[model samples]
Every structure is written in C-alpha cells, then in structure tokens.
Target chain A: MSMTKLTLQIDGRSIETESGRTILEVCKENDITILTMCHLKGITDVGACRLCLVEIEGVSKLMSACTTKVADKMIIRTSTEKIKRYQRITTELFAAERNHVCSVCIANGHCELQKLAYDVKMDHIRYPYLFPQCEVDTSHPLYVLDHNRCIVCTRCVRVCAEVEGAYNWDVMNRGTNVRIISDFNTPWGESITCSDCGKCVEACPTGALWPKAVVQGQLNKAPEFISDLIEKRKMKL
Target chain B: MRVRKAKKEAEISKNDPRVKFLANKIKKENYSPGSLIEILHTAQNAFGYLPLNVLQYITKALKLPPARVFSTVTFYHFFSLKSKGEHTCLVCTGTACYVKGAQAIVNELEKQFGLHSGQVTPDNKLGVAVARCIGACGIAPAVVLDDEVLAKVEPQELTQKIKSKLAAS
Candidate 1:
C-alpha cells in the first residue's frame, strides 16, 4: 500500500502530507495545537472527544480533525472564536461531571485534562456538576482509584482491550453512570487473572488511575515523547 | 479451638487500626462531597485499602450521603475499599506489551499462583492485576512487582522470578 503525498493548508500554513492522513496529524506534524480528548497516538481515531473539531473551508458542519482525512487542496481553520467557544463548551461539559478539583488532585499540575481546561481558560464550570455516583477500585497495589477525575475518553479502555489484549478494563455501564471496570465487574485486586501491569493507569489521560501515594499537588505524568515517536513512525511507514 | 479464636481476634485487630486511621485522616483533611475522590487517594495510601468505615467517613465528611459514596466507589476500576494481600504483581498488556507476549506471561503467573486474575491466594500472600498500557511499550510484556519493572519476561523466567520473590518474601 502506497500513500500519495498532497499539499494542504491548515490555519494559513501550507504543508505537504500523505493523502490519507487526518488533518489533525497534518497540523500536529507542523506544530499546530488542537484540543482533543479521544485522540490517542497510533490507535484508531474515534472522534468521541469532539475537542478536535475544525472548520474546513466549504464543509457544511464542523468536522473532527481526528476522523477527517486530508484531501488535495484542502483548507482548514482551527482557531476561530466559534471553534474556541465550541471547545470551551465541550471542555466545560467534561468538567461538569465527576470531580475535577485541581488544587488537591494528584494530576493537578500535570494532567492533560487540566491543561486543556487551562488552554481554553475555563475558570469555572458554568453548568452544574452532575456528580454521578462512581466507584474507585483500589484492588491494585501500585495505583489509586478516583472515578471523579475520568472524562470518559475511553483511552484506557481502548489501550487495555484493543492494544494490550488483556481486555481487563472496560466501560461497564452506559450514559451518566458509565465507568471503567475490570473482569465480571470484580474489584481489581480480586481479578486474579489481571497482570497488575499498570498500563491502563498510565494510558489514562486524567487522574483516574494514578499511582498510590502521589501527593495532591504533585502528580507527574510521563512525557509525550513516545506518542511523538509513534507519530513519526507512522509517518515513516 | 483456642487457636481459631485467637486467629479471628488477631484479624479484627489488624483490620481495625488501618480503618480507624483512614477515617481519622479523612476527617483531618476535611474532604467535602465534591472532593471525595481526592481524599480517597489519601485514604488508599494511609490504610493500604478503603475500608467500609473509611467510606462511611468520607460520605459523612463530604455530606454526600451513603448511597452516593458507595455508587462512586463501585463505579471506577481504580478504587479499592477492601483489604488486599501482601504482594501485588501487574503485567503490562499494552500494544507493545501484547505484541511481546505479556498475555502469556500473565497466564503463567496465574497458573503458578493457583489463582485467577484479580484473586488472592487463600494464604493472602499475593495479588495479581493487569494494566492496559504502562507507556513502557519499548520493553514489551513489562511486569511490575512492588514498584520494580521486569522487562522482556519469558514464560520460564517469569515463573522462576515469581517463585523466588514469593520464597524470599
């Protein structure tokens, strides 16, 4: 399979990319920052987060850059006020659920969700917090449980079942009460078949599955160097 | 008969102090309804588990009521309000780890321990869990035991390592 190279314009910058690459990838390669929650590097793009919505010239509605592959002569705008408003509202909706107390959370400083909120300048959650009932499974020794921090991105679920093949983690319920669970909905500690590897915890973009004993104001996240490396590898391929 | 009674008595004492300590700690922190999850982490570290009383304390402290706290605790995979065994073994089953036979290693460990995933032995000596991706995919099939990483573990090597660790502990 060969990919044809094509030139496209993103936010006024002209760049040449492969025919089948998404606009998000094109923008990312060119150092453009687009807000996204559901986009994971080297994994299938679900466009569930809705944070990567971009205004394509001639498109009827805003399209998700994650799912929209680039075409020849395409023009895109990523930062119009309209787009910012949409991004802000979407971020607030995420913040409106569970608990995102940045001051005392483990991922306060280093969380991607927190950074995204800061990027959009969401000083307060305008909408009332749903505060859905959620459980934290602390059966695993190395990590802690805090469901309130989850944004329902499903990155952890996809990485665990699809990428890791353990199928140990999943979003068990639906709608407002949805949450990530382990085998037969058992406690993580009770799942004897679980490998206890902490991959899902690491893959999580928020403070959902953090290391045990991480200080409230000092959660450290692994850098995005690997994601960048994966992107580079995909481009090379 | 006396030995059985003593064992039961000792178990109660072992579980009591940790639970009481967590309850007091959560109270000291003043974790409110909105901040229950944040305090849950603190409780996990202070007690090595989230006991029933600690959850009750959180409900009362946060003013969230009981059912709400219970539902939240059951909703996330990361929360553990129960007691765990002495040792924990986690295998990375991320994309890189999967391609590297992390699954096979997990299976071997399950067999050797005479336990299934998420179960502790009757002796309560060890617990096993699996993670999706630990971001260390470069070293596929990564396994972490008590904060130490064992990379590129073959099936035979894994069994031997677990045996040695269990024996030493």
Candidate 2:
C-alpha cells in the first residue's frame, strides 16, 4: 500500500503533505503555529478544547485542525481575524471557567494554559469569573489533583487509558459543575485500577495534576514523553 | 442481630432488578461501547441516579475504562451519579430571573426546606436544582416544581406553595 502525497494551503502558503495527515500535522511539519489543547500526540484527538479551531475556505463553521484530516488542495487559514478573535475568546473562557490564579498555581511558570494565554495575548478576561468552589484531592500519596486549575482537557484521562492502560481518571457532573474524578468519582489513592505510573501527571497541561514533591513554580512536566512513548510502541507493532 | 441485619440488607440489594437489568442491557448490546450511553440512561431510569457500584459494573461489563464511562456520565445534565429525592424543584437563573431575585427564592428554599442546589433533602422529600435558563425568561423568577412551573414567583410564595403541597400530599 503506497501512501499518496497531497497538498494543502495554510495561511496562504502552499504546503505539501501526505494524503491522510491532519491539518494540524501538516502545520506542525511545515512550522505553522496552530494553538491546541486536548490534542496529545500519543492519544486520539477528542477536540474537547476549541483553541485549535481553524477557518477552511469551503467550511462555514470553524473546524479543529487536529481532528480534520487534510484533503487535496484544501485552503486553511489558521491566523485569520475570525480565528484570532475566537482563539482569544477560547483562551479567556479557559481562564474564566476555572480558578486559574497564576500566582498560586503549582505550574505557574510552566503551564501550557498560561503559555496559551500569553500566546493569544489574553490581557484580561471579559467573562465573569465563575468562582465555583472546587476541591483539591490530596488522596494520592504521590500526586495531587487540584480541581481549581483544571481545564477539563482530559489529557490525564486519555493518557491513562491509551498509554498506561490503567483507566483510573474520570470526570463527573455537567457544564459549570464538571469535575475530574478517579475510578467512579473516588479519590485517586483509593482507585482500584490506578497503576501509580504518574503518566497522567506528566500528561496534564496545567497545575491540576502535580506530583506531591513539587511546589508551585518548581514543577517540570514532559508531555512530549507521551509522544515518544507512542512512537516507541509503534516500532513493536 | 447485626449479622441478621447485614444479611437482610444484602438480600434486599441482591433482589434489586436494576443490577440484573444493567447486566442484561450489556448482553443485549453485545458488550459494545457504542451502547454505553443508552445502558447508562436505562441504569439511571432504573436506579434514579448512577451509583459508583453500578458504574463499575457497566465499565467491567462493557470492557471500558471507568474514566470513559464517568466522563460520559458527567458530560450530560440528564445523568446524575448522586442520589436525588422523590420530588424535584428547579429554579431558573436566567438574566431576567436573576435580576428579578431568583437567588432569593433559592435561599428561601434552602432556609425553609433545607434544600440546597444540586442536593436532596435529608428526609428524601425534595431535591433542588438550578437551571441557567429554562426558556421561562418571559416569566421572570420562575420556579419549576416537578412537572409544574410557577411563573413570576416570589420567595415567600414558593415556600408557602411547597410547604402546603408537601403537607397536603
């Protein structure tokens, strides 16, 4: 089975890519910047976060680049005025939806959500801050799950199921009340299925899931390791 | 006596049709993950809310990660993993109602019936839930009691209505 080569236009630049590659992949390969969340390299793309939304010429609604596979001669504009406006709004919503006080967060200096806000140049959030009381689960001996800083990206949820095969992390409730939980909404330490592998902590994009050893501003996460692990596993297959 | 009580409790739970019904639902779907939401809907219908054990049972039966089942359950407003009361009341918190003092009604319900938002009364008589907008913005400060909607409502009136209804019924 020979793979077919295809071409797509991104941000008015013509880029050649493979037939089945996603727009996000093409952009990444050719050094075109497209903001993303809920798109970890190793796992499947759920498009839970709307930051990666792009404007395609023929499409009426914005589509997430991570999930939309590239087609021949597709014209994509990632940094259009409309795309930029939505990106800013999406970034603001992420900040306003949760209690992401950067000064107090564990991943204050090293968080992707923070970098995303900076990338989008989000100076102030327009939406009213929903200071809904959330919890900090210190039930796990080695890690902590802070609900306040979580963006509900489900990165931990995906990493646990896709890579580690442990299926421990989960979420409960609906809009404005959604919460990440472990094993039927139990404490992470009390989970019967968790492997204590800490893959979820690394996969987390915010201070929501951090090791107990790391204090605020001192934490380091290697989410790229997830992609590396996936790439390595592919060698065996 | 304690052992006898435990035995009776176990027997009661064992006889619950929902447990068997959920098991049968999984079998009926041939253990496909696509039917997970439907199975959960049936479970919620049979059991009123999704309990931890029931979710665990569904996860194991469907061969799904518990997180996957939980995310699905949490994503929808129709599903509840916690127990609810026999009767339910919803307060509309749309902008019109919010300006018209819907929060006051919620407070009165809390103070009078000890019903907080997203919680059931201790006696299992009532549950209180909040709605962002139930399309009743025309009638500001609306309250929905079970299937009945009370428009242009006040705290005192809602309290009195609920109290009288509960007392009478």
Candidate 3:
C-alpha cells in the first residue's frame, strides 16, 4: 500500500510527512526534541506521563504528541515558554510524588527520571513531598520492585503482558493510592504467571525495577534492546 | 475430609441468595468481560460490598486476570472492598456544601460516633463517608443515609436521624 503524504508546520518549520503516524513520530523524524515518558518503542504509547505535550494551533488544550496522530495542514509548537513551564512542573511533581533518592538508588546515573529532571532544569521540587510509605519488593529472586521510585508509567505492565506474554504485572488502585501489583497484589517471587523473563526490568525508565545483582549507581537499563529485539523478530531471515 | 468440607462450603454458597443472585446476573450478562462493572454493581448491592471471594468468583467466571478485576474494583469510589456497615451516612462536601458548614456535620459525626469519614463502627452498625459532590448544591448541606437524601440538615438533626436509624430493629 502506498503511503499518503501530508504537510504540517512544526515549530515554524514546514515539513511533509505521511498519514497515520503520530506527531511524536514526525517530531522524532524531523529531529525535533519532544520529551516523552510512558512511551517505549517495542510495546505501546499510553501518554500517561504527559511530558510530550505540544501546543497545537486552534486547540485550547495541549495535546500529547505520543498519542495524538498528525493531520494535514496542522500547526504545532513544541517548546513554547508555557509548554516549558508545564514540563518543569510535571518534572517537579514526578520528583515530589515519591521518595526518589538518586544517591541511594540502583539506577542512580542511568535513571531516565533523573535525566528528565536535568533536561527540564528542575533544581528543587516546588510541591510538598507526599512521603507515602511505599513497599520495596525483593521477593523476585533476580529483581526488585520499589514503589518509591515508580512514576506509574506502566511500562513494566505493558512489557510483561505484550513482550513476555506473562501478564504478571498490572496496576492496582487509582490516584496516589495506585500501585503496580503482581498476581492480585501478591509478592513478585510468588507470581505464578511471571515467566522470569526480566523484560520488565529492562523496560523500566527509573530505579523502580532493577536486578538484585546491581548495587547503587551500578544498574544500566537498555530499553532500546526491547525495540531492537522487536526489529530482529520482524526480519525475514 | 477436605473434599467433604469443600462440598459442604460449596453447598452453603449455592444456597446463599446473594451468591445465587450474582450467578444469575453473570449468566444473564452472557459472561462477557465488558459486563464486569455491571456484575460488580449487582454483587455490591447484594452483599453490601465486594468480598475477596466474590471478586475471585467473578474473575473466574469472566475468565479475567485477578489483577485486572482487583484494579477495576479499586479504581471506582462507588465500589468498596469492605462492608459499608448496616447504616451509611454520606455527607456532601462540595464547594457549596462546605460553605454552608458541611464540615461541622462531619465533625459532629466524628465526635458522636468516634469514627472518621470512610470508616465503619466496630460492630458494623454505622459507616461515615464524604462525597465530593452529589450535585445537590441547592440544598447546600445534604446528607444521604440508607440511600435517602436529607436536605438542609443541621448537625444535631442529622445526628438525631442517625441515632434513630441505628436504634431501629
């Protein structure tokens, strides 16, 4: 099938792209910097983090680039001052939501949330810390699930269900009370459906999910590995 | 012995009217996963709240993951995992109601019953809850007890009604 070409204005630059692709895909293709979380290449884009919000002309509400598909003759501004302000606020909230102590974390240097904070130039969180007592599940023989560092991105949930076909991880509850559960909120080690594939650990953006073998600042997660594996699987060789 | 015990428990569950009602409702819904919320509503109405076993039963019947059912149950505020007690007092704390001293009513209930909002009495007789808004702003301070909405209520009057409700056989 031939792809239909469409024209759009992004950050005052006229670009021509195909139909059915999302604004995020177009931005990435054009080398336009658009921030994103809760979006991994291999699985699906839920647009939960709301970091990739772009100001579309004639639209009052800012649309998330990851989920909103590009249309014909659409105008989009990625980094307006207002957008930057909102992005900084979102980064600050992610910091203040839970106890994300980078120094003590396994993925200290490699954490995506930490990088996002630096990218947004978030020096100190403006909001008051929730300080809710979160659980650290070390029940999995090879991995750990720390709720303190989790941003509720649901990447692990998607990866487990989609890639590994385990369907072990799922989100429970709502709002601040929300938590990632394994097999009806049971311990990770006790999860009957988990295939012990560790794809979830690889897809996690923060120190929320890490292997037990890694200590503080030693964890290195390769989320691209998931997308790369997907590409290899599609090869006709 | 364990097999006999299982059979006995199954027989008792089969005889339970609430369980029977839930089974019939699930069957009526053609066991579709989309009817989970509807089934849960019926189950809650029948059993006062969703017990773990009832949720498990629904999960099994719907062929859904336990986590999925659990997540759905916890997402909605209307659904409660624990019983809301025999008598429930839901005070509206919407902007309009708050301005009209709805907080005073909630405080009075806490003081009189020694239980906070979203809490039930030790004996399971009374439960106190707060609503963001029930859309009854005209009657600024509205309270719902046993599904009956009481409008323009004073703290003392609300307490009096609750006391009477609890005292009744």
Number of the top lDDT candidate? 3
Docking class of 2: acceptable
Pick by lDDT: 1 or 2, better one = 2
For A69-173, candidate 3 gives per-residue lDDT tens digits of 999999999999999999999999999999999988888889999999999999888899999999999988889999999999999999888887778888888
Give candidate 3's error at residue A49 in angstroms.
1.2
The TM-scores, chain A only, for the candidates as listed are: 0.90, 0.97, 0.98
Lowest-lDDT window of 10 residues in candidate 2 chain B?
Answer: B1-10
**Interface DockQ of each model:** 0.02, 0.34, 0.36
Decreasing TM-score order of the candidates:
3, 2, 1
lDDT of 1 by residue, A1-237 (tens): 589988888889888888878889988888899988877786678898999999999998999999999999999999999999999999999999887778778787888998898899998778998877777767667776679888878776666655555656666545787776664455766542355666667777888888886777677765354355446655743
DockQ preference between candidates 1 and 2, better one: 2
lDDT by residue for model 3 (B1-169), tens: 0111121111227779899999999999999999999999999999999887788789889987777888888889889999999999999999999999999999999999987989999999999999999999999899998999999989999999889988993
Please provide TM-scores, in order, for all candidate models, with all chains considered together.
0.56, 0.77, 0.89
* Top model number, DockQ: 3
DockQ comparison, 2 vs 3, better candidate:
3
